[model samples]
Target: MGLDPQSRVLIVDDFELMRTMLKRALGAFGFTNFTEAADSNVADQLMVEATVTRRPFSLVFLDWNLPGSTGYDLLCKWRGNPRLAELAIIMVTSESDREKVQAALKAGANDYICKPISIDKLKEKLEAVGLGKVRSA
Candidate 1:
C-alpha cells in the first residue's frame, strides 16, 4: 500500500527544531497527523497507547540519540514485540557510518536518513519503503 495522507506518524527526537523540520517535510508530502516525543520513554508509551487505542502509528522518524535510550535500542525493542513489529520505522540521525546503517537495518529499521535531511532524500526513502510514489520536486 502507498502512503496514506491520513496515516499517523511519530517523530521521536530530543531536539524540538528537528521534530518541527521533520513534520514540515512530511507535511509537504500531504501528511498531517503527527505526534512528537522528546525521549524514548515517551515515545514507547505513545506507541503502545496508540496501538492499544486501535490508532497505531503507521510510521516513525526516530533519532539515534536520546536522553535515556538510543534509537537503535528502541528499534530492536519494538521489532521484538509482535504487536509493534510491523511499524515502518526510519532511523533519522546524524550517524553516516556504513556499519551503523547496517546495524539499524539488521535491527529492523524500514529505512534510514541522515541529518541534515534533504527533502529529495526523504522522498526517495519514503518511496523505497513503499510509503508512496512521490513526485519529483
Candidate 2:
C-alpha cells in the first residue's frame, strides 16, 4: 500500500532473518521507518515506551510464534490497552489454518499475511486494511 515513507513501523519476530526479510519486503512498498523486536517482551517494552513518549508505531508486523508470548497474545494485550488499541497489527505466520485466521481477525488483527510473503500478498493485505496499493512496487 501507500505507506508514508516516514511511517513508524515495528517488526516483531524471534528470527532476525525473518524480520530482515519482512523489512525488505516493506522496503519495496516504500516504507523506510522500522523498529525490530525479537520477541513479545521487547515489543511490549517498545510499545509502552513509545506510547509514553507520544510516538506510537503506525503499524506492526507480528509473528505468530514468538519466544515469550504468541503474536495472538500480544494482539490481545494491545487490543485491550486503550493507549495501543488503535495500532495497526498484521499477523505474519506460516500457518494458514482457517481457525487461526478467524481467531486473529476476531482478536483485532488489522490483517494477516502468510509466510514466504510476496509483495503482491502484502499489498493485498494492506489494501484490505484501507491503506491502498503501492505506486511503483
Which candidate number has the best TM-score?
1
Per-residue alpha-carbon lDDT of model 1 for 56-87, expressed as tens digits? 88889999999898988999999998987668
lDDT of each: 0.89, 0.87
Per-candidate clashes come to: 1, 0
Flag clash pairs in model 2. Answer: none
In the order shown, the candidates' Cα RMSDs to the true structure are 1.3, 1.7
Global CA lDDT of candidate 1, please?
Answer: 0.89
| Model 2 C-alpha lDDT per residue in residues 1-137, reported as the tens digit of each score | 34455689999999999999888888887888999999999999999999999998888999999997899999999999987766789999999999999999999998898988888888887677657656557
Highest lDDT scorer: 1
